[model samples]
Target: MEDLRGAFAIVTGAAQGLGYAIARAYAQEGMRLALMDVQAERLAQVADELNAQGGDALPLVVDLADAADTERAAAQALAHFGTPRVLVHNAAILINRPFSELTLADWQREVNVILQAAFLLTKAVWPLMVTAGRGSLVYVSSMSGIKGFVNESAYCTAKHGLEGFMKCMALEGRPHNIAANTITPGMYMHTPMSERNYPDELKQKWVDPMLLTPAFVFLARQDATGVTGERLNAWELSTNPPA
Candidate 1:
């Protein structure tokens, strides 16, 4: 485990699912948090839970699709938490529609949430991280980012774009003691989104998220040196039962 006692962090899409899990992991290690999302009620609930665990967590609700809104949201995070040492771009949207039936707006919106939002958030915090001379930026990508998936053209394109974007950021940010890495998590069980897509029978056979939080903590810590522009898979990393 890496020492992160004084670090401050920000997690987007933190209302539920992967975002919430990431935030909780940081909180457990005593990292102050800025949780941003569109879901006010659930976002607040997450914040409260972190606070209950004796973690400092701030909630900021904003629509990432709007450029100005995303920029403003980042500003809010900085104002509330000072310069964050860790930034996780975990918010994303998926439109599961066949290529022939997908609309132009659907494609645009999907890309906007993943690619544009990451750009805006990173840009907003760039100066702060530069001034601190140390920071970590983690992008929550998917297997789709590295490969293709049915009914996932828009999502896949946007996630693949993140790989390129994060690599470039890693190169530029490295000179400033900042690292950027992307994690391409495979399908997992038990998230708000999963409640909609996963059946009860399938949940038992999927990867449990608890097993992956440690990697997230490592990435956000100082010990993750020289680990930039890399992609990780949770299921593969956690397969220890002779699978």
Candidate 2:
């Protein structure tokens, strides 16, 4: 595995849930972090905690749904830590409503956060990665990307788009030594968002978000020669790492 110590990583939606877990894991590896989230207060709290633990972290408050905000966040991150070796596009919004009830506004909101933001952020960071000739771009995907689910029209569509986008990135980034891939948690976790949608009983049966961190860490450390354009299951990767 590549050494992560002293490397810079940018993780979006890092104020809570899987994003927070990914940031925490990176901090433990002694990696410097740029943590972005729409929640300013919570993002600050996470950064503070990491700093207290002797980790280098910067909190960037941003609404990914806004193109300008996404661009600004990327610029701030690059300014703080030039050309992050790892970029995790984990910011997303889920609007669960029946197909008939979903409005154009709801669909647009979901698509902006889940798809457009990824494009903008990646575009912002692309030149830096090319200059470095080594970088990892990880899209936090879901089963919804591959399978349709009721009441998740917007989310599923966005994720499906993300999957295709990552593949194109992988192909284009090959010559530059930038690896782009997708990782699916494959099980529900007891996150703040999930708690709002899942019953306590159901949440108890789901895997911990932390369990999915290994795959992320692994991908971050890898170069383009490693793995790209692949959809990996976090749960399986955590149990048995790819050879």
Candidate 3:
């Protein structure tokens, strides 16, 4: 395994939930961080907490749905830490509105944050990762990525697009030794989004998001030759990592 000590990582949606858990995991691995989120105060608190624990964290307040703001955030990260060992695009918004009730603006915001921001962030970091000769890009996906749900028209569409985009990136990145993959929670978790969406039954079975961070930490050590273009289960991978 690659030595993650002092490695750099950029995590979006890092103010709370799964993203927060991943940030903590990276910190424990001795990785420096550039955390992006819309929640300014919460983001600073997380950064302070990590810094207090001997972790290096730079908190960036950004609205992922705004293309310009997303680009600026990526630029700042690059300036602070030249090339990231990993880029985890975990920022996504889910609004449960029926098709009949959903406005075009509503659909656009969700797609912009989840899909458009993915493209923007990846595009900004692509050259750096290529020059560095190795990198891992992980997009947090879900069952909604492949299956349709009752009130997730925009979300499902963007997730499906995300999978396709990763496939293309994986194919292209293979030549440059950059790995690209999508990962689903695989099991229910106690996240802000889950709290809003999960039923009582799933909540009862839900585990802490921290339990799934091992899979992410493993992926952080990978290159194109290691599990690219795959849709992985975080729960399964964490339970039994690759040999």
- How does each model score on lDDT? 0.83, 0.91, 0.94
TM-score of each: 0.91, 0.97, 0.99
Least accurate stretch of 10 residues (summed lDDT) in model 3? 218-227
Give candidate 1 regions above 4 Å deviation.
198-202, 235-243
Better of 1 and 2 by TM-score: 2
lDDT tens readout by residue for model 2, 14-64: 999999999999999999999999999999999999999999999999999
Residue-level lDDT tens digits of model 3 in 1-243:
788999999999999999999999999999999999999999999999999999999999999999999999999999998899899999999999999999999999999999999899999889999999999999999898999999999999999999999999999999999999999999899998989998899899999999999999998998897889999999999999888
Question: Mind sharing the TM-score for model 2?
Answer: 0.97
Give the per-residue lDDT of model 1 (tens digit) for 43-117.
999999989978899999998888999999999889878888888898988888899999999998889889999
lDDT for model 1 comes to 0.83
Candidate 3 vs. true structure, TM-score: 0.99
